[model samples]
Target: MKALVVYESMFGNTQQIAQAVAAGLGKHVEVEVTEVGLAPDEISAELDLLVVGAPTHAFGMSRASTRADAVKQAPGGTIVSTGRGVREWLEAVHPGGVGTMVAAFDTRVRAPLPGSAAHKVAKALQRLSFPEVSDPETFWVKDSTGPLKDGELERAERWGADLGLLVNSR
Candidate 1:
């Protein structure tokens, strides 16, 4: 089985979690990690699973205006996902998922936010005909530009491993 982990990050926290998740997935199947800017626009039949993730902005997935706002607040002026966000990538991806297992995840501050990037992504993927393989996941961050809450990376890795195992089993 092969899995692609695609992600968008404003600061570095989401990317770090994506890498950790990929590392865990690599243990159970062939896995590739890429930023949403460079992610493929089509999912081929050969790809067995797709994992999409992004940092929640203003509640849900980042929009152009939200992304611009994030860029302005980027720590050290270092924006990890300067080019594209998961929203744009999803918009442009081909509508097909006949044999593909899909999952969504997000990074956000541990607050009572009203929306979720993962949920939005999952809904979009479902609209594209992808069968969800798992419930949407959320990894907590400390602040806007975050140092992810302690052990969040480890938790994400475990979640990835479990996801990989689930797909491999099926």
Candidate 2:
């Protein structure tokens, strides 16, 4: 199966997780890892699985409040939309029988408590009719900049491998 891993990272913590996911998935199937700023039109329709990840902000997926404070960010309407990285990528595709295998994951700081980016991205994917949706996953970090805590990358790898198995079974 062909898989794509897209991610938005501020201090490279999320990117590391994305790479780990790609590595784990690559062990079982062909995978492509890319930054989330890819043009919507650039998204390939032939992909069998789409995995998206981002850092959580403002108790949700990069909501507008968190994004706007940085610049004119916000992929969608919220920081979650911050340029619509995950939203646009999924939206740009015309998933037929196989796109239903989409999965979502997110990275967040484990302090003061907040939301998960995976939930936001998963919800967005579901709205577009991606079937057999897997549960959203969360990876914790030490602080805002994030060292990713412990065993997070290993967990990401496991998630990737498991997700690959799910798509391959379909």
Across residues 77-127, which tens digit of lDDT does each residue of candidate 2 receive?
A: 232223655545555755555354677888887776756778888887777
Q: Candidate 2 has what TM-score?
A: 0.80
The residue ranges of model 2 lying beyond 4 angstroms of the native Cα positions read 63-65, 68-100, 112-114
TM-score of each: 0.97, 0.80
Superposition error at 48 for model 1 (Å): 0.7
lDDT of all predictions, in order shown?
Answer: 0.91, 0.73
Model 1: CA > 4 A from native: 95-97
- Superposition error at 42 for model 2 (Å): 6.3
Candidate 2: worst 10 consecutive residues by lDDT? 73-82
Over the stretch 1-170, how does candidate 1's per-residue lDDT look in tens digits?
99999999999888999999998898899999999999999888888889999999888999999988887887676798989799999999984448798999999988765889999999999999898999999999988888999999999999999989999999
Instruction: Tell me how far the alpha carbon of residue 127 in candidate 2 is from the true structure, in angstroms, after superposition.
Output: 0.6
